[model samples]
Target: MAKIKALKCKECGREYPVEPLHVCEFCFGPLEVEYDYDEIKKNISRDKIKKGPVSLWRYVDLLPVENPTVGLNAGFTPLVKAENLGKELGLNNLYIKDDSVNHPTLSFKDRVVAVALSKAKEFGFDTAACASTGNLANSVSALAASAGMNCYVFIPSNLETNKIIGSLVFNPVVVAVDGNYDDVNRLSSEVANEFGWAFVNINLRPFYSEGSKTLAFEVAEQLGWKTPDAVVAPLASGSLYTKIWKGFNEFKKVGILEENEKMPRMYGAQALGCSPIYKAFKEGRDWITPEKPDTIAKSIAIGNPADGPYAVKVTRESNGDMEVATNEEIIEGIKLLARTEGIFTETAGGTTIAVLKKFAEKGVFDKDEVVVAYITGNGYKTMEVLEGHLNKPIHIKPTLAEFKEKVVGQTINK
Candidate 1:
């Protein structure tokens, strides 16, 4: 494992010792993990990575943990060519970095939870916790179970039923707060400080976020070690978007990708109900103004995102744009992907696909440019939202007459 040299404050440039800390005591800004890239470049190579495990642990050289207890099978999801979707949108080259099929938990949160729990164990903590909208709670609960650690997951009370049950099945103590995700996060932060337990998103954030980089790594490798022209990812707290940018840069620094390779435009997708980052980007502001989320895409419904500013910075720095999808658009996007690619994704993925279509319609993408859109979760977890929206199946009698009359493409008389 590549040892972290320090935890550097993103705003003030102050460095602190490697420990379970997130905020800078002096500046109150978030801190990020700084690794010794020189040491990593010594033995980290494409051949070494390809020879490693078939999971996210294949990039263990870049991850923070030495012995990952949980996610030995979390990363390296498929980067499908998306020919059907591309044809529908009139784009020649498009791909979907599908994480909806991720193991243990059918979402990208499994990647981050794997690293966080490993570090929690490495730090000798037996309790794991987090504040989540939905997917993070499920990932944390499942991984903590595998690691034999006590787990607590705090989430918004209005989360989908399957999401609540998904975490409960893992046997974690689940807390449903009365308010929104931001409210749950605030209480979790206090509990993290008061109870002295490792809250993955609050205290162990720097290490946990490194897990998102594997998404970028898999994309570049799947594209034959080349960065795409653009990438569209759903923005919740915005940590995932920024980390993907960091991941591409890290690969270039380590000689995996060429130093002169053009970086991908880091596009962000959000629900119109809660799009602080998109609002900031549109108004040409450097800071974010919080909003109250009311979208069906509850997973990316953080009204006050902690990493909103950084997400804006990364988007501008990479010459990227952000877009929002309405509730109707989100639902259509979910059905579109299912009909075209046979991938049934949650609202977060729907938001991504909807934004991708908007961008394509606006001619934002070159016909030949490689565009990769991320689908972060499976639709099965949030099937409740599809009620009264999807086309109902046909009902027929169990007879050959009915089979010929209604089942074999027979026109129904209404």
Candidate 2:
């Protein structure tokens, strides 16, 4: 039997049966999955999890599903000790939680889509769908294809060509909305109501968001069962940021880690184009105001983030903060990680890296603190953003002298 106990409203604390619901009928607040943690504690242990598969299912006892149907090898990505990147920023201990190489789809969305589709199947849904900016669409389409379910992916019309192609190759029904991500999400919400499809981030959201906890699980496990001093994650709907903090705390409650140490400070990153959460944090407000996104970080471009207030609260409670990155800084961040860590990540990651650097400059992170910055997507999916920015190939003749003049001479001069 699934360990899920109930669906609880995040605002008014009303609990309901585990069903295809995402909002409270009374207060109209978002709902979250309530698990039977006591039963989970009885079955889950470090030894038990270590013996399971290296995928997200390694923590299956903690996940909501009893029968996972997809992404058998997602999660458990490397927590790289970014010595070069750390040195560049004058920090002694910095790491990159590189989810850009997650299995099947090579993005963190694979983790969420895996669990969401599993829950969809458990609920007897024959179709799976989502309103995504890019990564989630790619993941949902690919996983649904593998599961033999009809898939529909809705996205803003201005999504990157490669991201659109990423979902198309999976042969799912693709819908391009006429406006931004918020517009696409609103339309998808209406479609979910009319068609009754298991829209992953809509009706199936309580289950879908649980997948992000695996990132935190892997990070703590990778660091020898201890939370890092700080974490920096990109904020889209702010779901990932909040879930990661929950994962660490859950581990402590289950006796997997010590609670005596200070909780990891949770920092959030956002592109200046859509920085509602950051703005709220900066103004010391408990609420967020939406913005019209206009940035290259399309993957994290949710103008009205659903969990923006919660993200702000989490950051403040953890004694952390949020920061924004400009397009120029974001591009520079992408190049810095590539040159330093050989990890090519998407604009969301660039935003994360840029904000991390800003924090380092502001003395937000102590020099010896263990900091982990998450890189959520592969840069290959957004190569168009680097068209004129990256160095082009040097044209030269076949002759050795010509090669020397064009290539070797340039190298020598540099």
Candidate 3:
């Protein structure tokens, strides 16, 4: 009655014992943790989950770890009923899965790092590491420090300044590579091989990716055990997007969701400057052609996504579409979410919001259809992206006369 069966290859269906492995020897395809869902069904139920801890670990029956020791407080972020945002978008049933406040790191990466590091510890690894754009770096640094493990995080040199500081404060050895995210990942792979460090997204990826399924689990439970009609989530390496789709299906497989409930259509969002998944989806192709990263949304600016093909497959299977947003549109999307829902999200979230708007405008959703848009990180990490795009503050003195003339007068005129 083992919860996890093996690390099964995504292609060629090869199976290997659970270890810090991510690729198949025979096919070189990615490996994923295969579970014994029938065993899970006998042990899991709504009441069991409800009585568990109020965190991602509450769904421990589904995650790849047996005892999750890192990022204990991560996940179970708020699923806000976006009444204001819904009205603005002309949709009545819209929600925002706000992971901007996810514990320890303030991003969805916390969930994955939690599982990854926990599994790494179980595998007798002393060091935790990852190649990141921003959020993953911050998560690995913070969580690994909390777990008392030696940590190293690699990221592109040009990542946002605040993100670099976010990792630095956690005291992990941070490596700033001289290229884009893909380059950083390549270096991390070599380092993981050379040093035998548990790179969370590399050698430990089969376990790390399972953490993202908790987002889907939380959303379904939060929505009263019903899956949404559609979901719009940002795509970086496309892991999060595909895992979310997997989560909903898993719930159904475990009998947690009602037999009458339907799966959600999965919409993938990307920035116009780097949109290999969107390009592949639109052109009716199944494979991704890598693009050079060139977007303000640096977090989701992956040129070559490891899970890009799976993401496209899920989108097509779910009857969903992929879309990209320009820098201008991404900025507006951030502002719109802030103004309407009071949620200040990073560029990744802005990309999601913008694509959600496009889906709404294109009549992709009915008026009463349930839609959930994921906001993955806090805007504070990437505030520089909004520079000169927001209005300058009204520089009024302590005088009420100046306030009335410069602020109140202008307010009234507008």
Which candidate comes out best when scored by lDDT?
3
Q: Note the clash tally of each candidate.
A: 1, 0, 0
Superposed by TM-score, candidate 2 places the C-alpha of residue 165 at a distance from the truth, in angstroms, of 0.4
lDDT per residue for candidate 3 within 38-67, as digits (tens), equals 999999999999999999999999999988
Indicate whether candidate 1 or candidate 3 has the larger TM-score: 3
Tens digits of per-residue lDDT for model 2, 225-253: 88999999999999999999999989888
Candidate 2 accuracy as TM-score: 0.98
Point out the higher-scoring one by lDDT: 1 or 3: 3
Candidates arranged by TM-score, highest first: 3, 2, 1
For model 3, state the Cα shift of residue 183 in Å: 0.5
> Where in model 3 is the C-alpha error above 4 Å?
none
Span of ten consecutive residues with least summed lDDT in model 3: 405-414
Residue lDDT tens for model 1, 1-414 = 345688999989899887899999999999898889899888799999889888988888888888888767898899999999999998888999999999889999999999998999989999999999999999999999988999999999989999999999999999999999999999999998899788999999989999999999999999999999999999999999999999999999988998899999989999999999999999999889999999999999999998999999999999999999999999999999999999999999999999999999998999899999999999999999999998778799898888877767655544
| Residue 131 alpha-carbon offset, candidate 2, angstroms | 0.1
In angstroms, the error of model 2 at 66 is 1.0
